[model samples]
Target: MATEAPKRSRFKRTLITMFKVGLYGSLLGLIALVVAVGIAMSQLPTYQELVRRDNLGQMIRVRAADGSTLVSLGPSFGRWLTSDQIPEIMKKAMVAVEDRRFYYHPGVDPVGIARGIQVSFQKDDKVRGVSTISQQLARNIFLTSDRSYGRKVREGILALALERKFSKEQILELYLNRVYFGGGAYGIDAASRRFFGHSADTLSLAEAAIIAGLVKAPSNYSPTADAEAARSRASVVIELMRKNGEITGSEAFAAEPADVRIVPTPKQNSVRYFTDWVLPQLDTLIEENIEPIEVWTTLDPNMQRLADQVINANTPAGAQGALVALDRDGSIRAMVGGRDYVRSIYNRATQANRQPGSSFKLFVYLSALEFGYKPDSMVEDKPITIGSWSPRNNNRGFAGAVPLRQAFAQSINTVSVRLAQEVGFRTVADMAQRFGVTTKVSTHPSMALGSSEVRLIDMTRAFAAVAAKGVAVVPYGIRRVTTAEGELLYQHESDESRVLVAPHVAAQMTDLMQAAVLTGTGRAAQIGRPVAGKTGTTSSNKDGWFLGFSSGLTTGVWMGRDDNKAIPGLQGGRAPAQAFHDFMSRAVASRPVEQFETQVAPPDWAETEPDEEVWYDSPSNQGQMVDADGNPIAPPPAGEAPLTQTEDPRRPQQEETLEDLVERAIDPERRERPQVPPRPAERAPPPRDRGSAGDPVERRSPTPQP
Candidate 1:
């Protein structure tokens, strides 16, 4: 018994010695770990240096005259709210969904880490991360989204350092402001403005919960696009808040199924096309930096909405349309690029180059007026061929020797051809180009009947230039740009060049266009007010347009298929004219109604006539009027050798003009295209008295030709 007791005592002593050694070894190992962590922490960026880092990426905000935002181009948002400024419910939401034990954790959650490791090993799910809120902030601020081991280690280490340097509130604030909430929103304040149209401080409990749920897979949980998944996720968030004691069960239930309707930001609308257009201009105006700048634009939200409604409601199925409204100064007040911005982002208003049809006649007439043609000039609308191309008017009819004003009003194709041939085609093409037609013009007699393709915005601006009384006007949007602190950055300068059209010529053209509204093919645009405009329909009804001006505003509407298919019965005077009438009616509703200025005065040659013979044309007078220099204006006699028809004797069968095969060939139905020949109507008599074309007039029929 004594020997057994001695052996037990020895074993006990040996166990005590081994226990002491192990305890000391563990203490040494823990001390070594502490030293290693301290060294690592010292190697990181200094706390002050880290806090100084900033990324307030610019959100180029385009605003209207009323100080309301139209759209934000980059990193979109309003203001930054500190933790104190943020609502308590928003804070609770963040803590409940992101990290329940945020207050207790030093930097990393050991329990979460253990679970993550087990899940990774069991299911090989690398995405089941154990990143705490601080770690997430570290990743967002200083790291890429790469899933490398190096990134994770750096994230954890930075998280620990952040926790040591910042208090709990600071860490949470940093996390809230740095995390992305998807949909181009980068912070809590940005997300609040994006989905709710208010500041973060104004977020309701339901809004807070909805945004909280977006912390994981924001796009999938987007309430705007995927409301079902977003609501389900919000319900999960409310339940989590209840589980974490952040809210009561009643509160969770009340907020779970809340009907969330997002007050959409204007940035989501088709006006984004306008903003995109102006952003590149800003690039030249301002230096690139993180600070945001404000651009005061010429957008009228009311008019813009009206335009969008008109286009979306009026366009045919699977068809596209564009509208542009500009003031006399060439400020773009409203622009709708397409029917819907989501389906197609292309800005048809400024980018599309569709044929202008009869709308091109405006410049042709303007050029004729500039070259000393009176509004009362006479043109025979018979089948007068020009070269191989024999253009024919739509509807298979013609007026014999219609007054120039009547010819333009009726859109008599033969008359336009005669006029273009009388005044050099170069003069007409030059006039259109000067008035802002950018497309290459064919100068064929067909061009006089609107044969050139032009962007809607450019054509509208060209008309706006005329409304400005002959001063060339460039359409501008951004009026002024300012820094966030209200410091002047840049201001727009107007290029009001007056070299495009002559004053007398513009006045006369305006007079003739008003006659068009009174009795012309554009009768559909009658708005119970004096207006000046033109109608255009391309070959095959492929494009239709109405460009008009009212109350010092010019708006153009273009309709066509992106695939260039003919629209049945679509004509410039049909849908396009009516749509222009609707848009202008609303656009001018708030302004005082006024008549277009029709300042009629005698031409340079009218003063030469005596009182008794003033209205009489002398035998010495040629077909053309003289210029200010009194040089007797002479044009080649109107009847040129009747243009011979191009003949093809190969098998002795068919003959066609180049323009017939090329520009005007697509129309199987009557596209209302221009003419080379046509059935002649009874000759029209000269009017008893010709006045300025502001009001409609009746003319006696001329001597009929067999």
Candidate 2:
């Protein structure tokens, strides 16, 4: 029994030794933690800098190149200033509200901490904070927003070290600089400059007090953008000041007036017109961090006014429209995105995508021109069907036979569809693409009928290509940017590339478009000078588009609704054309203009008689001898359709079919006239019975005078 007792005693002694070791280890760990925290706290920056960074005393102003204010950043992002720069009342209010015993306490108040803990337990929330100026300064300078026990210990340690290293004034200054006011502002100096537009040293009582009020929450008390909210927050600060004995009841009452004069932010330049279109293009132009730049566009504000006037005068009351104009170098000069900038900031000129309607036929004719087809060539402007898709002329009947120029001038849909099919959809699409139509095109036959969407800027740029004689210039707004000292910072010129028929080919197209203005569908586009343009009136009158160009400028106008609903009784010729004319008259009022150049080369079949046979080259089969007599130089390829000869005694042997002829006429859809639908025929009244008596006196044909 005694041996067993001794063994138990040995176990007891081992247990005691283990307990002692554990206690010593824990003590060492606690000492290590204390020493680590002390080391971290000793490395804090000078308190003055922390105060300079946190004080809510700053203003930030943005300006246009012309020195006009565009916007102002206020106190939440404060400009730096010293404590003395602030009003005494403001300084006292902050101290009383944030930490009343700030001057007496080393860095923290035990009473405030106890009160905070008591309130936190009662409220079931961490709603009470007892952080003094020094503690706040320590947290802001070296810690994150974590609220763990470790963070609190670190904050306390740093606060003690801050008091040991700096005077109260210096600590207060550092505290002000290190606190975050909001809006990305780190210091009171930055905050002051951002909100009040002045240095911290020159602040007024109200301004300083209001800035001090932002300590609780910067966004909530942002004065420039949300004055009402700021006033509410300021009232809270005033109440706190009154309760803390920093201000008397009367003073608190006076501060409650909440009369804040918020600095007016500069207008957005609103860019109601082309700004939307211009924004996407700026990424490649400006450097990063250079923000809130004001672009003084080439928009002639007066011309924009005139455009608005004409559109309103002609358009239906509820209709919306857009107009874009570019100078000779393709610089956008003026644009009216819509009738009202406020009702809809969606820029119709740049955002709205609508069909071009008959206006798109220009590219078709341009393709035809490139394919050895002449403007005056004969084509049957009749009802036609391809693959069960039948298209009718605007007249709803066949013209039997008509000049290609005349057919296009009348905008005959049958002719356009048939011509598009024959001209090779690929070639026509290529022409459209080359002319600056960036939208994906419809590959079907109806594609020739303007079944594609295009923006005003793109359309205007395309027409500018015609004006520039085939050289397409990208439209740009920014010309130059310079520093305040006049050192050149940026200079931009047109990025140009050729995208269409040669100069002569472009001239032919311009001539045809001009004829459209003279006597065709675009008669409303006439501007007294040599002008080339096309008018597009979409089905159901949903969209009206007019794109035209003079010697030195190109303009595109569209009128429609925002909801895609059809505009009643609206045509491109009326509203859009008038808008175009008004803008052009003002745009070109002072500039000397040049006439459109004419085609220099004789078109492929220009001199050939209608009945004469002409040889043509095929893209696939080149230089292979096959005679008019049907003598095969080589046996026709197996499985191919046999080439048959037909005899036409009235003229020469007929080698091409009507389909082939139409195809040849449409190969390159360039035109000498803007195409329109044929005029429908009117029915004649049948002869009446009384006509029987008149029929007896039917006039006889006169004999040959010879």
Candidate 3:
């Protein structure tokens, strides 16, 4: 009995010693934890300092004309809302989804930490996030987004400090205003505006639920990135809200995915091209400062979408396409830089300088009209040689005499060159510059054929000038610039009285272009409306273009390989014109139909006299007269020499006479029937007549006739 009692006492002593060691160990661990927390807390900024600090970088929020955001350049923030200013539903939704024990916990939730630790142990020690709202705000304002044990410890200390310093309402308000959402939005207000096109105070239950769901994975649940995923996430938030007693079952059921209307984001980031083009101009408009600014642009979201769709759909494989649309006043309505913005950001519409081909004939024809040539005036379309450069019609044969309208519509190379010669090359270049083409236009003969490279936007703006009935149209994208506080910085204003062309001249040019779209090379561009446009195909088919205007809108399209290599079987009248047709058809569906002004009547002196029955040896077919199709035909029973006409009365007297000019331009020895060379191998079949429905013909070489 005595031995048993001694043993029992020893057992009690052992139990007591073990209990004392465990208590000392726990107290030492607590002291270490407190010291570590003190160290972390010492490194953190005060809650007040964090609240006042603006960490967001320079933000440029670009919006469409209707006040919808097209893109945000940097971290975007909306108005800072106080506790009361925040919607109750938003608060509940966020609390329910992010941390159900947020109100009960003193900064850190023990239950959540324990659960997270268990999960980590089960998952091979992988770190798991168990952040509450306070922790998120601390991380957002005071720490980087690093997933490490050290970061987590610091985050917890900062959250505890925040909880002690700020009231629950203050913490929640700060948390809501400082969280990052997808798409560059930095706050709930900005996110609400970005995703739903409205303010957070006006957010419905469904929108609040969606915004709350984004806290877990912003990009994965971003409404703009994937509406379906966003709504699915929102459903989880709704269920959580119901379980937390934040909402009733009926209310949760009522929050349908369809009720969550997400603003349509630009597909393929195409709107970025427009935003990128406008971003640089901001420096010119505003003072250099880091202050957040808002730029109201003239972009029509619908038209921009359509432009993107059409350009991507019509651009051929192994090539790229670009498009630009402008209102009559030159407000850039839509722009597509390339087939895919992500693939290439080199904005072809504004940055690329490419030959407009026959589309450049607008200036030549406008100059001719200014020089007393009417649409009905007769012009010879025979092969002509100038300084060893013999330009031929696309079909290798020419129409001997045709109306200026017919020549323009057919995109006749010979007729354009003849008119450029008559009007003077310098005059054509000057006309182009005066009409809004900013590119340096050369006085070379090929310039009359659009060989000079120019930007699509400039070409579209030049066409807009014609549509504006002589008024100059300087293409502009930004409508106004303002500070985030709504202080106006700059507003665009244009002079309406700055006429670039005479109304009658513009009307005549429009008449010629209308003929081109109606019955000429641009027939493919007809949009079941009064569309006046011209087709352009550069030499070797390296560039294809269609510039046109209908219903007070001017749009230009260009298609080609980026390397400037020739695209097989490409023509401006084919893919480009069809793209134009497809885009404009949908673009102008809601607008009222309008007709172009009646063309000025031809002057008395412009009337065509009876032809003197001119005949010329076919450049091909060996001295036989060929038809428009380049086929040899029976010669006229009574052939006559080429007709000779008097000088135009409008020609300056000091200008060289036609006969002198012709003598100087042509080599007398090489004029008599130059030897015909055999046709070279072709990548495509021989082009059909311009009037045929087959592939539209275009000038294929810069020098030497076919």
Give all candidate RMSDs, comma-separated: 10.5, 11.2, 13.9
lDDT of 1 by residue, 326-431 (tens): 9877788888898888888999998888888888888878766664566777767787665567788886787766777888888888778766764546667788
TM-score for candidate 3, please give it: 0.66
Q: Model 3: which ten-residue window has the lowest total lDDT? A: 674-683
Using TM-score as the measure, the top candidate is: 1
On lDDT, the leading prediction is 3
Q: Give the TM-score of candidate 1.
A: 0.79
| Cα lDDT of model 2 by residue, 1-706, tens digit | 8699999999999999999899999999779856865676567665444544323333333333344443444433444456666556757756865788899987768887788778878986563667888888777767876765567667777887778778887777666655666655566666666666666666555566677777777777777668777767767777777788777888777654266565554334333455555544546766642332344445555555567776667667788888888887777776778877767787877777888888888888877666545565666566676555677765677885676677667778887776676555666777788877888876666778888888878888888888887787677766654433355545776665655666656776777777777778777777777788888888889999889988688889999887778888788777788778877877677777677776556544433332212334579866353434323344346785434322223323322333543444344453212221111111111222214422212111100000
Ranking by lDDT: 3, 1, 2
When summed lDDT is taken over every stretch of 10 residues in candidate 2, the lowest stretch is 697-706
TM-score of each: 0.79, 0.64, 0.66
Instruction: Supply candidate 3's per-residue lDDT for 100.
Output: 85
Candidate 1 regions with alpha-carbon error over 4 angstroms:
1-56, 77-79, 85-88, 121-127, 202-205, 257-261, 264-267, 600-706
Give the poorly placed runs of model 2, Cα more than 4 Å off. 1-38, 41-116, 123-203, 223-225, 235-259, 264-353, 372-387, 390-415, 418-422, 475-493, 497-499, 512-532, 549-555, 558-563, 574-656, 659-706
**Model 1, global lDDT:** 0.74
Residue-wise lDDT of candidate 3 within 486-510, one digit each (tens)? 9999999977889886677788889
